[model samples]
Target: MSIKKNRLSQNGIYGPLTQKTLRNLLKKELITNFGFENMHIIADILIDRFLKIISECSVEKERIKPYQTIVFAVDRNQRFGYGKTMSQTKLIPVTVNIITHQELEELASGKYLKDLRPKIVTRILKEAYAQGGVLSLNDVAIICGVPNTIIKKAMRDYYKQHPDEILPHIGTIFDCGATMTHKRIIIKLYLSGLLTKEISEKTNHHPFNVDSYISSFEQVRGLYEEGKGVQQIAFFTGFSQSLVKEYIQIIKELNQLQNNNKPNGLMSLTS
Candidate 1:
C-alpha cells in the first residue's frame, strides 16, 4: 500500500472507500499525475461539485434508502453440480437490495396500471437474484403485499418472455429431489445447441446441473423417437416417470417449433 493509503486505512472512520476518503484520493491523484501547480484547487472544485450534485438525486435531498433484506442461499462456489449429491451444499446469508428508491418511485407512479404488480415482482426477483440471493415466491408475495398466485403469474410471464434467462429463486437454486423446472429450462437450452458452460451462465444454473440435465434428456430422446411409451423410457433410463414425461413433452414442442421455422431456421437466442 502507498504511504497515503496506509494512513487512511489506519485512521479513516468509514474505511478507505467512503466518499470523503475517495475525494482525497482523487485530489492527490490529480496533483501527482498532472504536476499542476493549482491542481489541488481544481480538484477540490470539481469533486465538491460532483458530490453535491449527486447527493441531490434523492427527492428529499436526504440519503436514499434502498429496500434491502438478507436471506440464506446456496453458495455458488461450493456447489458440485450434476453427478454429485447436494447434501454437502453450504448455505450462506446474502444481503440484497430488493429495490432502489428510484425503482420504488416508478412503481408507485404506475399503481393503477394492470401490469404494475407483475412488473414489480419481476424487478424484485431480478435484483435479489443478481446479488446472489434466492427468494421464494412466498417471500416476494410478502414484499409485494400480494398473494403467492400473483408472484407465480409474474414468474411465468417472465419465463415466457425470457426463456433463455432463468430467474434464480429458492426452488431453482437448491432443488434437491424434484428437477421439473430446472430440467425443462436446461433441456430447452441444450436442444437449441448451447454448450454446457454457455447454458450454465445464461440460465444462472451451475454447470454440473446443466450437464446432468443434458444427460437425462439424451437418455430419453431415443426411446421416445422410437415410439416407446413414457414408462418404457423411464424403465430404460432409470429416471422417474414424471421426468421422462417432461422430456418427451419438451421434445415434441421444440421439434414442432423447429419444423415450423425450417424455412428460415431458428433465430439465435444467444443474441
Candidate 2:
C-alpha cells in the first residue's frame, strides 16, 4: 500500500477550519467520552502536546535530511499505534519521518554513539601519553570528539589504572609552568657537572633548549668571574663555548660601566 506523507508546519499553527474539520469527524465520539466542556479542553491539550512532539521530531529530521517520513498510527481506541497494521476498529494512521542526530551518526558510521564513546576515550589516552602526558582536557576533547568532562573522567580512570605513568602536572606549549620545570631540571643537571649532550640525553630535550635554560640567568656570569674559562664554563653549564663567550662579554661590559662611573683620581683626593 502506498503511504501518504505530510510536512509539519513551521509556525505550528493549524487553520481554524482544520480543527473544525477534525472535530466534526470525531465530534460524536469525543462528546460521548468527554462532556461538552471537557471536549474542547481535551482537544486543546492533545493539539498542544502533539505540536510540541512533532516540532522536536521535525527539527531532528531536518538535520538528518531535508525531508523524511516516519510511519506511525493513531488508534481511536488505543490512543497511539505504530506501523501500518490495519486496526480492527476505527483508527487514525500517522507517518512521521524524523531522524535524530544520533541516528544519523550511527547510520553513517555503522556504529552507535554509545559504542563509539569507548574508542574516543582510548584515543584520548593514547594521544595524551604520546604527547608525554602533558595535554589539557579541552585539547584532548577537541581532538577526540569527546566532551571535556568525559575526557577528564577518562583521564582520572586512566591515572588510577596507571598511576606510575601520570605526569606530575599538565603542561601545554603556551604555558610557562612546563618551561620553568624544564629549566629547573636542566639547572640541577648542570650544577652536577653534566655536559650538554649528557643533560640533553637524560632530559630527552633538545640541546638548544638546554643551552637556552643555562644562558637565561646570571649563573654563567658568576662562574666566569670565578676564573672559569669559556670551555670550562660550557662543560659545567651545558652551554656551548659561543654562548659562554656571549655571557662573558655582557659581564665585562657591566664591570666596565661600573668602573667608569667611579670618581676620578682628583675627586677621590678631594674627598
Candidate 3:
C-alpha cells in the first residue's frame, strides 16, 4: 500500500512518514530538553531516536513489520560530510519492527526520559571504543549523565581502555559490536562538553546506546547564581561529586596557571 500520509492515531500504528515525523519531533524535543545550541543537528537526533525505537520494538512481544528500505536525510551544513551521511558504510543497521504510539508516548514522557539516557550514552561509547582503546570518566558523564562512579565501577577488572568491549546491555533489541576507540571517543566528546544527545545527532548514530562491542569533562563555570555545592551542580549536570570537584579544580587551576604566566613585572630600561 502507498505509505500513509499521517500517523495512524486511531489505530495507534505509524507509517514511514509518520515514523519519520515522529522521529524528527522527538529529536527536536530532546534537543530543547538538553539545551543544545543547534537545529541542524535535529536530523542526527532523529536518526538516533529512530534506531533506538526500532531496536527496542524489534525484539519485544509487539513486533513491528520489517522495513524494506530506510532513508537518512543529509544536513545542509553537512557537519560530518557527504560520505558520513551514507549509513551503509558508516553505520551498522540493526533489524527492528515499527513502533506503536503507546511505546513512543511512554518513552517521550517526562518520567521515562531519564531511563533512555544510557541508551544515548551507549551509542557514543561504541564510536569511542572503535577509535581508541579507552575513554575518560569525564567523557561518559557528558553523553549519558552517568556518573563517573558507574563508569569506574563498570570498568572494574577490565582493561581500562577496552573494558567490556563486547556486550549488549542498553535499550536495544539485539546485540552489537564496538571497539576501544569508539569508547574513547565517547568519553572525549563528553569531556569536550558535548551531550550524548548532541553527539548522537552529530555522529548520525541514532539510538546510540547499545550493548555492542563495548561499554564505557569539563569546566564548571558557575553555580547557577545560587549558593550550591558540588551536589547541586552534579544534579544539574548529571555528573558525580568527584567529577564535579575535578572539573572545578581543573578550571580553577587553568585560571591560576594563566594568571601566573602573565608578566610578573614590567620590563625595565626599554628604549
lDDT of each: 0.67, 0.49, 0.42
Where's the lowest-lDDT run of ten residues in candidate 1?
Answer: 56-65
Off by over 4 Å in 1: 1-66, 80-89, 176-182, 263-271
* Candidate topping lDDT: 1
The candidate maximizing TM-score is: 1
User: For residues 24-86, what per-residue lDDT tens digits would candidate 2 score against the true structure?
Assistant: 545545566666556677766665666656564353543444433322222212211234234
Q: What total of clashing residue pairs does each candidate reach? A: 1, 3, 36
**Candidate 3 residues 175-246, lDDT tens each?**
122233334344334434566676454443433341121121322345623456888888887767765675
When sorted by TM-score, best at the front, the candidate numbers are: 1, 2, 3
lDDT (Cα, 0-100) at 99 in candidate 2:
35
Per-residue lDDT for 1-271 in model 1, tens only?
Answer: 9999888777776563455676776677768786754767777898798667544332341332356655555566545335664356554455545555766677688755345555667776666667565666787887766789878887777777776566676566545434376777777677666799988788877777778777877778878878889888988889889888888877777677766786434432222
Per-residue error for 162 in candidate 1, Å, reads 3.1
